[model samples]
Target: MTPSLHPTPATHLPLTINDSIVLQSMLGVGAYGSVYKATDSHTGQTYAVKCLSKTGLDSRQRAFQTHESTLHSLVSGHPNVATLHKIVEEDDCLYMVLDCGVEGDLFYTITERGGFVGNDVAIKSIFGQIASAVLHCHSKGVFHRDLKPENIIMFGQSVKLVDFGLATTEQVSSDFGCGSTFYLSPECQGGYVEMVKSYDSAANDVWSLGVILINLVFGRNPWKQACPRDETFSAYILNNDFLQTILPMSTELNEIIKSVFCLNPRKRIPLSDLAKRVQACKQFTTPEFSASFASSSNASAATATIGQSGVAGGTCFVSSAQREDKDQGDSGVDVRSRA
Candidate 1:
């Protein structure tokens, strides 16, 4: 008998722009907007709709939108990156409908399942996919200012880089000093005036990737030590010294991170070399990893809830319970904008 191909509860129901996409449940909210799983009435395809409230958008948001639009134009067609289906506006509010992948963001995965994946093969596989996406962005003269676990999405074993809100074009010099402060490059923190002229955004992304790789292995931000501090970027650059803690990793992996995270942009490891090194690592050829890396089943029943539960501006994502409650039926339905 052929297997039944019914849509899982996670499928988003369609809605139009201007009309309220039923708030099935909040998927996630960031500084600019909230993302919810919504369906398109016309196509029956699931999409992630990012809703930016007019009330919340300030000058910073304007700059973000401008850069985001530029990056979207540059990288929209690439498969490794999130596909932008449509951009809609209602009054001052802006809604962007993006392709909703089978699995969700990598940060949600790593957060719920403890820190850093233990499977070496899994890490290499995911890393390669992410690198391909990043490399594509680079080829188009776009730099992803923020490249972290929070922005990566996993579908089975494959990964796609999402959240291009911080992406900037290569031709234009970025004036805004934005991105999660933790992932900010040392030069970016030195004030835009000083760093804009010499800022090598490609290298900064490399550094951020290095930080993310460390987090994948250790489960926490490598630069985060002695309780998070509110230090300036320059101060963090001067005092940041966590390289010694990497003694636990294999020497090859350790060297890769070091080279990628080099303080000098010109001297940092190129993506081409990094990709080659990761593939050549001993972990890549191991029998266990080679065989089982992409075979894992998507059986985890945790339904994610994004956006702040109670706080006006706060956002959070949590997994759904194993058994779906009748009252929680709306949790899996998609919410869309009125067309």
Candidate 2:
């Protein structure tokens, strides 16, 4: 007979779940749940098990959890995307077994290394894999609304994208301001003179990817938010050379950013083409900027090389590079439908 799983109210964790699953120490906690580092009893395999408490989650929140589970299961096999092995449901909570990223996340990696300023090879490898994962998701009829560095996890040299709580199958959404502030497109941010009744979620994903590319190269965000209110983004809208003028980026890199962040959804570069161009680009920044970044001992000093890009102050950002996936719902909209 299979052993029953029982939880202690204090930790809300069970010693074992059925025949194979064994819960270990707690990894982190989200709005309604906690993630644990667990192991398979029989095979001795490690996993990241997320436990969502049914304590006070309403029907809608539970549906969102189902939505997250269903979408993640659908895209589990992709190498660059984190794998969802199985989900176990009990009377008190829900548990999802997923791949554990041991080394850390891309954000931590970049912050630890100071940045990827002169590392074209690592950029191509990491960014290319991320683009490939997005393409696979698009092919599967799912759109990953959130694609920031914080959502990406690393296992040694390999990386996998995670946190699909906000994903949707639909191409367009009326849910304005749905994603992270820094990574959102102008249309997604929604306060333009032209009334945007709805916006393309896919295009918005591409725009987020662009911001992540910049983060990998510069170790800082282009702007706190992508709306007219943010002076940095406002300047970019008025002047085509705004990004180039503020930072010492190469022509190839500048053009790519311009294309990726284009105001029109229809004009945004396709993921496939963007993937190719990323590898083809000769350099990401000028030698002077690269040298300065190399000389700077800390990330803050390295980011200061850009005259007014706003890197020193954490005042503008809602999330940091060190932020964990446990705070998933707090970072983005989790609009979900009943399963």
Candidate 3:
């Protein structure tokens, strides 16, 4: 995991923007800018405004910002995505007016609960919305290269996908190492070592979704990176059911993961089918996730991360639940525009 994923509290923001917009608080923080909770004084309406400063952006960065806005426009119509109402540009910065959510994100919620298991109803409702949003993007030829708990804001069980900075219109990209380590697909981690020509961006999105499923049930990543150097991933490569040892996974859930986590991207399950499988899944966790083994699960979540620190990026990914004391924002997921 990159150190940048840890969202820090923004200490200062303009008192107001343009003329009637009053910036209330920080929603999310990212590489190029930070999202703020703002209001329209004239209309007395609320919005989550994503602010991007032009001060430090170079030619490439400026182009990347434009590209992100374009792709986000293509898929923002979806019900599960955060709506980008309009773009307002000033001499100093760019502001994106978006849907306002008073409730916080899934990352903050999961981090607080230490992974809520045996609640298939809430999991299904949340993951189902996420699947619909991803499928909507793929249908429009836009790929959300970044998909994780951090990028999703929750309204109880419902979710909205955010942070299109890493999005792309390309069907394939040779731009290896574009996302965070834990959620990256094997083909995406193709740095100089693999010399990978290109990989299917759509398939790459599916792999990230698979990791997210593991996170929903287990409250931890299945492995750090999909690379062979990682011990847990290597064990899973040799024996498909290795994840069962770390977490109480059911056979049905295992089947779905196997299909999604297939080594061959071409052989990976289609998004439409995958969504149905997820909706049909009866149990993602065994009886162990109940009160009886709650303490045991917590102990194991800590140990698994220690034993299998991921190789890429030279950082270990601990569960968001165990990583911090409290989350500081109600909305915003900031993924760096690595691609």
* Per-model TM-score on C-alpha atoms: 0.68, 0.86, 0.83
Q: Considering summed lDDT, which 10 consecutive residues are worst modelled in model 1?
A: 301-310
A best-first ranking of the candidates according to their lDDT comes to 2, 3, 1
Off by over 4 Å in 2: 1-14, 291-304, 307-339
Highest lDDT against the true fold, candidate = 2
Runs of candidate 1 with Cα error greater than 4 angstroms are 1-15, 18-24, 54-66, 114-116, 171-176, 191-197, 225-247, 283-339
lDDT of 1: 0.55
Better of 1 and 2 by lDDT: 2
For model 1 the local lDDT of residue 233 reads 24
Per-residue CA lDDT of model 1 for 1-339, tens digit only, reads 000123222224444564544424346545455666776555566777766666556787666665675576568777768777777866666677776765555665666654234466667777778888888999998888777665776666777677776677663345445455446666555533244454677877877777666555444444421112423222334543333332234556766766875666779898878877877777412243224323533212111111111122111122222112112211111222222
TM-score of 3: 0.83
RMSD of 1: 10.9
What tens digits encode model 3's per-residue C-alpha lDDT throughout 114-148?
54445677778888999999999999998888787
Candidate 2: clashing pairs of residues: none
State residue 310's C-alpha deviation in candidate 3, in Å: 14
